[model samples]
Target: MSEAAKELNDIKRLMMLLLLKLGASPDEIALALQVDASLIRKTIPSRKVKKIVSEKG
Candidate 1:
């Protein structure tokens, strides 16, 4: 990826984590970002997803 593209991707990934931290589900995050849930799942590490989901409730 180009540096700019990588940076944008990083920002998107960070936003995903932030949304999750705020108790948004992956599906919700995807919807808010206009992306697919599979992309959200692919972007975030599984362990982090597990941690956030567990802590969300």
Candidate 2:
């Protein structure tokens, strides 16, 4: 992929992480972003999810 596209994807992933930290579900994020939940779930690292969940819990 092009550098610009990669950067955009990285930005999107960061947004997904922030949304997740704020308690947004993957489905909600996907709907809002007009993308698939699987993509959102895939883009965010598993460790990040665990950390967010632990911090929120």
Candidate 3:
């Protein structure tokens, strides 16, 4: 993937992980991440979710 696309994907993944850890609803996370909730849900990993959330907090 192009560098810009890769960066965007990484940001999206991190946002999803953060949202999941924060216990933010999918819709809320999507809004915060400026993307669709389904996309975030699909991209984020369950294992890393908590880590991202905690780090953000």
Candidate 4:
């Protein structure tokens, strides 16, 4: 990918992490970003998800 696209994707991932920390559901995040929820689930690290789930739970 081009540098700009890579940067944008990195920014998206960071936003995804922040949203997860804020307790936004995967589906909600996908909807907000106009992408599929499964894409988010697949892209995000399980460690991050576990951390958020543990913190929220």
For this target, which candidate reaches the highest TM-score against the unseen true structure? 4
Q: How close is every model to the real structure, measured as TM-score? A: 0.69, 0.68, 0.52, 0.75
Q: How close is candidate 4 to the true structure, as a TM-score?
A: 0.75
**What would the per-residue lDDT of candidate 3 be over residues 1-57, giving only the tens digit for each residue?**
899999997886666666677777677877875888777666664545553344443
Error of 1 at 37 (Å): 0.9
Judge candidate 3 at residue 43 and give its lDDT: 66
Write down the lDDT that model 4 would get: 0.80
Model 3: per-residue Cα lDDT at residue 24: 71
Off by over 4 Å in 1: 45-57
Candidate 3, superposed: residue stretches over 4 Å from native: 32-36, 45-57
* Top lDDT prediction, candidate number: 4
Better of 2 and 4 by lDDT: 4
- lDDT of model 4 at position 17: 85
User: Which residue pairs in candidate 1 collide?
Assistant: none
What would the per-residue lDDT of candidate 4 be over residues 1-57, giving only the tens digit for each residue?
Answer: 899999999998988888887677789988988999899889885355634445533
**Comparing 1 and 4 by TM-score, which wins?**
4
Model 3 clash pairs are none
